[model samples]
Target: MSDNNEYQGRIVVITGASSGFGRGTALELAKRGASVVLAARSPEALTELAQECETAGGRAMAVPTDVSDRNAVAALTDKAVARFGRIDVWINGAGVAAVGRFDQVPLEDHEQVIRTDLLGVTYGSHHAMSHFRARGKGTLINIASALGKIPTPLYASYVASKFGVVGLGDALRQELGEEKITDIRVCTVMPMAHETEFFEHAGNYTGKKAVPIPPTYDPKTTIDELVRLVVEPEDEVITGWQGGPFSFLHRLMPKAIEKLMAGNTNAVQMGESMPAPKTSGIIHQPSKA
Candidate 1:
């Protein structure tokens, strides 16, 4: 049987909905007939996205939010419940990155990256778990990265944050199983670097244009897998054709993979042209794509 109509009238909450994977997934889910709650730091962008989703023949609400702030995230949950009664699925996709030598990146920028990427997921999981436990059913979808499983240079803090997300999801899933909570679900999606506004919004100390290291995948590929997970939940999904192989190799040949990744650090640092002077990018604020 087709699962296309399964999401009809279901309520979903997505962070980082203003742009990138979050935005793309929101639109696709809307088209699939899900009621979407869009949360991001950009109110204007969120409002515009909500209109698009409505035009796609689904209900949507925009809530400007800073996930780094626990209170703001809590309020986001409150507003979603107030508007849609209950959240059937929550996608914690809001994130920012800093691309540069670890020491060269500003201290504040590193801290902000952790706060937004790691702590943000922590907050979302906390609230979503509470609601799901009370209702005894819900899905938590955390958008992590392939980098989480295999470390890379020039993205130290980003690696740390994603690693935390992976750990958090595994722990949550294990606990739920231990408690025999069969209905509720926790899933983590790990995708290879994709074409997203992340490079543009990322804080750069590299002085060169930022691009995915190599073997970049399409954003749609990741989005489609995420949408599919809405109906078919898994403990963890590593998307992209190459993602699984790379992860496996990293496990079998940890030293070899580390050496190759270290060699590629120079490629990530050297781009076509010098990038603009360093700014905090979207770590501390919002940037429209």
Candidate 2:
């Protein structure tokens, strides 16, 4: 649990602030007196969120950005700095997933996932690290997934991207330590399938609607953990009770875990009813949602 007023006057930058965990985190932090910089592809949604933050008793700014574009991401950083002077916390919460059999999913769709989920994170970390190094104290939070450590079937590209994210966060942590930058913290968060807008925005080619696997946790489970890190920094955190057991099982019996995922692929990958047409979602274009 975090102390009351722990986030007061902190400057937090959150991507994917239009909805889901990013939106929740921004509101919760704002209520605690943190100024939040909201970034996403939807300007209208971001603006509305910023107003909501202000109503909660903290300052806020909205910068419409597509994380996949390095220039746009750079511009976003500039806007945040211009508005708040400095960023205390940077959370890479923007992500898109595609679900279908690996061979059946479009090649371009697979690449889109890599660009947004993996390279987008690279871009955020690159800019945030430069700023944090200059400031000498800051937190970089990379939102990975439980799938990063334990791969699941039918989400090949998403699994690949998240695996890369996990590796990137660890590598960055070590580099910071080697340079004796102990004041700057690099934290990675891995959560099991949770209730979020992820399924709605995800690209799909599975001929069925996308849905979170059973035992889905609430979005607050992840958001609360994110808020806690603002006060007590850590190297890595696996949110949600289910995620803890999944990580443990993966360590004890990797092969068995893989087999279990394979068996559960159908339920994890698609809904029973028919789905909308194949779409690349917001990966190739800005999200209107």
Candidate 3:
């Protein structure tokens, strides 16, 4: 049994809590005794997850929020603070991706990816950092993807957004230290593809064919990693042993990695022919709300 007593009286805000990792993480954290604030654009889904949290003997609030809007995100932070005295952990799990050759994809999709993935994380971090600063302590967990480290074809925009997330988180850590805000920590959780509607809902700018990865995750794995991020916020956390190796190879041999990326099927559009999302760089965005 894991000890969830640490968050007994804390508050956690999770974006994109409707489905995928966000929903999983919300349930996991709530079970750990944290009062969770669930934010997602889909009111019904968010409410359902909130109900699950409540039934699990955990305190939770459902806030209908769209991460793409800065104001809405700020309002969520305000509401969280109003309900709970302080914000302990703010998770930016909302993200969107598109699968297509760059030339075949639309620029709107690139914009959408940027707005939802990069902008959403930034908004969450900005709002939460303020709250943490006021309280003098907290953790900001940004849900990123393995693609951030190992980019693959057909997801240039997605890769670009995640890279921005990783870079921003790193810089924020340094800046926080410089500012003497030692208690406020920053972490980025990078997970490989999990069983979710991520691909189905992902923006498909490329009219060329798009396919779905066969489902294969237990969903509990996401819960496990998310629990870790809350209980022990580290500089970065990466799941999926396979993806971990890809990260290593990418850094150890840039040229080899590049060649491998061009020829590899990691980011290939999943089809009925594909087994699952296991080997792909596609990951569930926690904040694609």
Best by TM-score: 1
Error of 2 at 149 (Å): 0.6
Which lDDT tens digits does candidate 2 get at residues 44-67? 899999999999998999999989
Q: What lDDT score belongs to each candidate, Candidate 1 first?
A: 0.91, 0.88, 0.78
Counted clashes in each candidate structure: 0, 0, 7
| Segments of candidate 1 deviating more than 4 angstroms | 271-275
| Model 3, span 188-268: residue lDDT tens | 887776767776676564443445332235556666877787868789877665667768888889789777765653444
Least well predicted 10-residue stretch by lDDT in candidate 2: 267-276
Candidate 1, 168-235: lDDT as tens digits: 99999899989999899999999888888888889888878777777888899989988888888889
**Which scores better on TM-score, 2 or 3?**
2
What ordering of candidates by TM-score runs from best to worst? 1, 2, 3
**Looking at candidate 1, what is the lDDT of residue 267?**
64
Worst 10 residues of 3 by lDDT: 276-285
Question: Listing every candidate in turn, what is its Cα RMSD in Å to the true structure after a full C-alpha superposition?
Answer: 1.4, 1.5, 4.5
